[model samples]
Target chain A: MVVRGCENRSVNALVVEKQKSRENLFLIGVPCEGILDWHKIVSEVGEAVTAVKEDGQNLMVETRDGYQLLERADFLHDSCKRCIHPNPMSADILIGEPLPEGDPNLARTTVENFETQTIEDRYAWFQKEAERCIRCYACRQACPMCYCEECFVDHIEPRWTESGATPAGMQGWHIVRAFHQTGRCTSCGACERACPMDIKMTYLTEKLNHDMRDKYNFEAGLDAQSQPPFAAVTLDDKNRFTVRGE
Target chain B: MNHILEKHTLQDLLQSWRQDYDVYLPQKMENFSHFMPLTETSVLVDGDPHNTRIPPKALFLPMNEALVKFTRFGGYEDAKHEIQSRIVFGIRPCDAQAVQLLDTSFIQEDNIDPLWSERREKTITIGLGCHEPCQTGFCTTVGYGPFDRADLDAMLTDLGETYLVETFSEAGEGCFLGLPVASEEIYNQALDIQRSAHDQMPVAFETENLKGKLEQNFKSDYWDTVSQSCLGCGVCTFLCPTCFCFDIVDETQRRERVRNWDSCMFRTYSLEASGHNPRPSRVERTRQRLSHKYVYWLDQVNQIGCTGCGRCVRYCPVGLDIRAMLRQAQTLPFEVSHAA
Candidate 1:
C-alpha cells in the first residue's frame, strides 16, 4: 500500500491494535510536501477553469476568465499547513527526498488559538459548526482509523448517540468522534476537506492529540509496538507516564 | 410583467417582503453561501460561488424532522409542523427544477407527505439566472440551462446595475408589482445575456442512449472503476439538489420518530435486518446512486434525476467528477436492442 506520513501512522496504530499484521504489509512511503486545497484554488480562480497544471511550487491554471499562477504554499490545506511530519516514520520502501520536518509550534499555535478563546465563545463556535452538520459521516469515511464494521452510531438496540441531524446528535457525534481519536489521529485533515459544509474538524482531534502529547509524552504511530494511551496497561503504577517504555 | 430592479435597492426589495412573507436568500456562511432568512442587515453576495453549498431542497425537506411525537401511556400524535409562507430568493434554476422533480415523488397518489407538501405550497421560489454561469455547472448538458425556469415563480436576469425581473405567476408579480417596467430594448438585452450564458456551457456528456447503456451494463466493471476512489460517504447525496432518501429512526429517549437524510452511498442504507445487504459494497452502492439518477428516474418520470448543479463534482473528496464517469460510461459496450 502507498501511504503518506499520516496514513503510515494510522497503519502503525492499526498494527498495534491487531487490525493488520505488519509482516504481511508492504508500505511504499511517498514524502508529502502538502495537499493543495481545491477549495482555495477555486476561490482564487473563480470561473472558466479549463485546465490546472500542478508543479513543485506553482499551479498554472488556465481559465476563460484569466490565467493564474497560484503559489502552492498559499493553497496548502489547513492540516497540511501545520503538519509536523511529512516523511513516513515506518515504510519498507521510500521514494523521493523527504521534505524538511514541519514546525511543532505551528500545530501548537492552531490548538492554542482555539484554546485561548473563552469557554462561552468556544462553545458558541462549536455550536455554529456542529449545527451545520448534515450527519453525512464523510469525516468518518475519510479517516483511516474509522474502519469499524458497524459504527457506534449505527448500533440500534443500545444506541450510543442520536442517529438524526439534530443539534444534540451532531454535537455528540463530533465530540465523541474526536475523543475516540485521542491518541490515534495523525492530523491528516481529510475529514475537514471531505466535509461539504466546510466544518473545521481537525481542531477537535488536534486538541485531543495535543493533550495526549502533553500529559503522557506519547505521539501515535511512532512505532508499531507501542499501544495508544487508552489501550496501554499500566499495572496500577503510581506514576501514569512511567510505565510507557518499561 | 417585466420590470427593472436597481441593484442598490436589492436588499430593500428583499427585506420589504418580510412584512407579508419570510424572505430567505443565499447569505454568506463561512466561505460558501447558505439559504438564510433575510434580516435587516442581510447583504447579498452576487454570483460568487454560483450557488449555495446545500440546495434550497433542504428548506422543504429538512435534514432532520420529527414525524411523530410519542406521549405518556403509549400514545402518539403527529408532530406539529408550522410552515411559514417564504420567498426563496436567488435560487438557481436547476434547483427549482429539482423541487419540481421531487414533487412527483413526495406528493404522490397514495403517499402525500403533508410536511413536504405544506412547505412547497408556502414557499415562493424566486430564481436568479446565471449571466456568467459557473464553469463547474453543466445544467445545459442535462436538458436544463442556467436560465431554466421550469419551477420558479419569477426569474431575475442581472443587468450590471439593474436586474430585469420576469414574473411568471401572481405571487411573483406581487413581489415587484410597484417597480418600473423594463423597456423592450432592456428586456431584449437580458434575453441576449441569458442566450449567451446558455450557449457558453459545453455539453458534458452524450446523453443519447446513455440511460440504456447504464441499464444494460449493470454487471460490468464500470461500477468498480468508478467507485474505487469513493469513500462511501454521503456528502454528494446530502448536498445534492434532487437526491432525497431518508431513514426514519425512533429516538426512544427523545420520544420522537425522526426522519433524517440517508444516502445510498452508505452501507447501512441497504443493510437488511437479517444481516444481508442487497447492495453490498461501494461498487453496488455507486451503481445504485448513478443508475437511479440516470436509468430509474427516466423509467419512472421520463426525466433525468440530476439537475447538474455540480455540488457533487466540486465537493467530492477524491475529485471524482460524475461527468467524467458518465463520459467513460458512454464507452461501455452494450448491444442495442429494439423494443418489440
Candidate 2:
C-alpha cells in the first residue's frame, strides 16, 4: 500500500490498472482546496493522465494503485477545513493527508448567526442577487457533489423552474439547491465560486452544516463505515435534530 | 493627469501590444457595441463612461462557445481550441469584479472548465474607473464603486486633461512599462477627480437584510404584479454585463458543429427534449429569475451576483426595474408559519 500527497495522477493511474486486475479496489485522491485553475492544471499534467469517462463523472489518473473504484477527497461543508473522505470507502492504499480537526467553535458561531437572521432578510438579499442570474447553471456544472443524471431545473415533465426571470422561479431554484445538499453536502463552496453573479451560496450550506453538527452531532462523509442520516433508521440514533412525533 | 494619446501613438501602442498579447477594446461593429480584437482595428479604446451594452465575459466565455464538437460516427473528437494571451483595456471596475466573480464560479471547484480557465489565465484585466457615473449606474450600493480595484490588474482613472494609470498586478505594471505616463501631479489630480465622481453618484440600495427579505416573501403577490408587464423579450439577460447563463445546442452546419446563446427569459429556454416545462407560467419563470439571483445564488455562492450595472433595469422593454423589485421584496409582509 502506497500513501502519498501531490501524487494524484500516478495514484489514479495505479488504481485504474489495479481495477483491471480485480473487480474491487479502493483508491483515494486529495480534496481540491481554494480556487483552482483546472485548465492550467490539466495543461500542466499533459496527456499522461487520461480521464476515464463514467456515466457522468470522469476519473482522471496517471496510474492505478489497486482499487477498482477511485474516490476523490470531498468536503463535508463549505466551512470544513479538511477533506472528510480523505481515505477511501475501503482502501488498500491511501493518498493525501489524513482528515484534520475542524474548529467546532467557528461552526457554532456561524450557525448561530445564520439562525438569528430572519428568513425574510435572506430571501430579499437572495432575490437581489438572483435577479442578476442569467440562469447559466454554471453553479450546477461546477459542483462535484451535484451529480444527478438530470437536475430538477432541467426537468420538462412538470417544469419545476420556469425558463424565465420570475421571482418565484428563482427562489425555487435556490431552495432546491439547498434541499438537495441537506446531510449529503460537503460544503466546498464550489457552487458559490462557480456563479458568475458572485452569489455567495456557501453561506447557506454553512448554515445547514452548523445545524447538522449542533443538533444531530452528525458530520457527513467523515466515516465510510457509518450510514448517512437520510439513508438509515436506527432506534439508538439521537433525535435531538428530528421532530418529536416523526 | 489627462494626457491625450495622439491617434498615431495610440495605433502604434495597440500594434505593439498585439505583438505580445491579444488586445481587446471596445469597437463599433455596425450599430452595436462590443469588445473585439484589436487583432484588426487601430483605435480600440474609446472613452465611453457608460457601461458597455455587453459585459466583458462575452469576450472570454463568448455568446457562442464550442464546448466539445463530435461526430456521431467518430467516437470523440478533440476540439483543440486555444485562447491566446491578451489584455482587455478600458474595462470598468464593475465589469472587472464581474470577471472575478465569474472566476470563483468557473475556476474554484472540483470540476473546472478548461476553456474558461485557459482564457482567464491568459487574459490581463485593465480597469478604467468611471469619471462620469452613468444615470443608471448604482454599483456603489452593492459594495462596489466605479473605481473599486478589487478585481483589476491595473486601473485607469480619467483626470480632466490626462489619464492616471495605476498598476494593481504584476501584469498590469508590465503593460505600462515603456508607454508614456502622466506626471505624479497629474496622478494626484486624477485621484481628486475620482473622489468627486464617487460623491456625485446618487443611486443607492440597502443590502443589509436583502437575503432575508427574499427568503420570507418567496410566494409573495408582488412578483406577479411587478412582472405582469414583462414581455419576456430577454433583452435584460443579453445586455447584462454580468449575466453569464447560456444554452448549448448541437447544430451541424456544413458538417461543422455550432452553438449559440440561449436566454432563460424565453418560454422555450427551459423546455427539455422530454416535453417537461418546470416553470410553465410566465410568473413562475419570472420568480425563478429573481430567486436564483437573490436566494439560491446567495445560498450557493457568498456574494450577491448583481453588480448594479443597471443594464437589465435600463434595457427592459416593459421597464421592469430589478432594483425596485428588490426594494419591494425587502419591505413585503408575509404570514409566518411555525414548522409545527
Candidate 3:
C-alpha cells in the first residue's frame, strides 16, 4: 500500500493495523485541511451549484446565477468538524507545517449536545433518519472496518432482521451495523459520505466511540503495539459483564 | 396548437388539471427542487425551469416496488398494481429524454415490464424548456437539448410574464383550451430563445464514435485509476436520470416479492451462489457502469443510456466525475489485451 496524498487518521490506523504483518506497506503523508461536506455545499447554494473552490477558511460556490461564499467550519461534516489529527500520527515522511491544535473538547461537546436531548427526541430523530435508509449497504461498503464476508443483516434462515423497506427493519440494520463498529471505528466519516440518502448515522458510531474511550481509556489505531481494548485480555480490565455482587 | 398563458393563472390551471390528473410540478424541497404533487402550499421555485435533484423517473419506476406477492402454502400472485392517471409538469428536457430511453427498455417487444408500461401509458409529460442551462447539464452533447420536444406531450417556454405553450399531441392540445393564442411574433421569439438555449449549453462530448473509443479501451489500465477513488456506492446510480438496474428479492415476511434499486457498485450485485464472481472488484464494476451507458445500451436499444443530466457528477461523494472519465478514456493511451 502506498498512500501519497492528504493525511487521514483512518489511513494511519489502516497502515498500523496492516504493517503488523505486511512489511511492504509505505506511507507518505501530507497535511490535510479537511474533507468537504457535499450535502452542506448543495444545501447552501441549491442543486444548481457549479464549481466549488476552497482555500482554507471559506468555499466559493459558482452557479449560473452567481457565486456564493460559505464558511468552511459551518459546513464541515461532524467528523471533520471535530478532527484533531490533521497530520498522520506516524509517517515515513511528512510534508507540511505541524500546525496549531484544534479544540480538544469538540468531540465532547458534540456527544453532550446529543446527550442533552430528551430520550423521546433522540428516538424520534433516530427513527426519522433510519426511515430514509434504503438498505443499499453503501455505508458498510465504504467503511474500512466493515470487512465481514457475511454481515449479520445478509444472513438468512436465522436472519437478524427481515430484509424489507419497513421502519423496524431499517432501525435494526442501522443499530446492528453501528454496534459492530463500536470500538474499532476511526470516526472516518466514509460511511456517512457514501450514504446516498444522507442518513445521519455517524452520531451512533461517535456516541459508541465516546463510551468506549470514557469506560476503557483506550483509543483505536493510535499506536502500532497497542491491541484493541476489547480484543486484549488484561488483569486491569473492568468486569462490567458480571451480575451484581456475584 | 400554440397558446400563451399568464404566470398568475398557473394556480387556476393546476387546480383544473387536479380534477382529472394528479398534477405534479417542480416544488422546492430541503436542498433541491423535485417534481412533487401540487398542493395548496406548493410553490414553483421562482417559476424557473431546471433539473430536479431526484429525477422525475421516480414517478414511473419507484425506489422500491412490489412486483409479485406470495404465500407459504399458496403459490405466487401478481402484486396489486394501480395505474394512476398523472401529469408531471416542469420536467426538464433531459429528464423527458431519459423517460424515452427507459421506454425502449421497459416497453419493448416480447419482454414488456407490465408495471412500468402501465404507469407510462397513463402519464402525460409537460416539459419545461430551459432558457439558461444548469452548470452540470450537458444534454445537448448527448443528442438532447434544453428545448428538445422529442419526448414531451406539451413544451413550455418562459416568455417573460407568460409561458408559450406548444402542443405536440392531442393530449397536449387539450391543455390550451380557452387560452390566448400565441401571435406569430411571440412564436418567432420563442424559437429564437430555444436556439440561444441550445447554443448556450456547453458541449461535453460528441458521441459520433464514443462506442468505438470505449470498445478499443475495454481492458485498459485506465479503469484501475478511475475505480480506485470510487467508494462503490449507489449515489451516482440512484440520482442518475437514466440508470435502470433493479434487484428482485422475496420479502417473505411481507408476503411479497419486492423490486429494489440496485447498483453495479455493490459487491453482492454480481456475486454468484456457487462462490464464483465475474465482476469481483471495483475495476470491473466501474467499467461496466460506463460501458452500460456508452456501449451496451446502444447495442441493446439503439441509443445511449446517459441523458447527460449530470446528477451523478454533482452528487458523487468522492468527486469521481464521469464526464472527466469519458473524456480521459478517449485520449488516454492503452494496450488492448483481449476482447471485452
C-alpha TM-score for every candidate:
0.96, 0.55, 0.89
Better of 1 and 3 by lDDT: 1
* Candidate with best TM-score: 1
Query: Whose TM-score is higher: candidate 1's or candidate 2's?
Result: 1
Clashing pairs in 3: none
- DockQ category of candidate 1: medium
User: What lDDT does model 1 reach?
Assistant: 0.90
Which is superior by DockQ, 2 or 3?
3
- Candidate RMSDs in order: 2.3, 24.9, 3.5
Q: Which residue ranges in model 3 land beyond 4 Å of their true spot?
A: A1-8, A15-23, A38-72, A134-136, A150-158, A162-166, A233-237, A241-246, B47-50, B332-340
Q: Candidates 1 and 2: which is better by DockQ?
A: 1
Model 1: per-residue lDDT, tens digit, B1-340? 9999999998888878999999999889988998999888877887674789889899999989999999999999999987899999999998999999999999999999999999999989999998887867899898999999887999999999999999999989999988999999999999999999999989999898899889888999999999999999998999899999999999999999999999999999999999999999999999999999998999999999998999899888888899999999999887776311
How displaced is residue B40 in candidate 2, in Å? 5.8
Instruction: Report how far residue A128 has shifted in candidate 3, in Å.
Output: 3.2
> How high is the lDDT of residue B161 in model 2?
47
Q: Write the per-residue lDDT of candidate 2 for residues A1-246, one digit (tens) a residue.
A: 232221232233333323223234344444333233222333334322334322222234442232122222221234333323333333454555555544466656655665677999866766766665545565665554555656797665655664333455466787788777666565555565445444556666666766677666765554333444655688876655557743
On residues B1-340, what C-alpha lDDT tens digit does candidate 3 reach at each position?
8899899998889889988898888786545576789887777677444588778888898877788888568888888977789888888889989988988888878999988898888888888899877767788888888898967899999988999999998888886688989999999999999999899988786665677777777788889988899877777887888888888877777787888777887777898999788999999999999999999998898788888888888767677888888887777543454333
DockQ each candidate and list the results. 0.70, 0.01, 0.40
Which runs in model 1 stand beyond 4 Å of their true positions? Answer: A239-246, B338-340
* TM-score of the A-chain for all models: 0.94, 0.59, 0.88
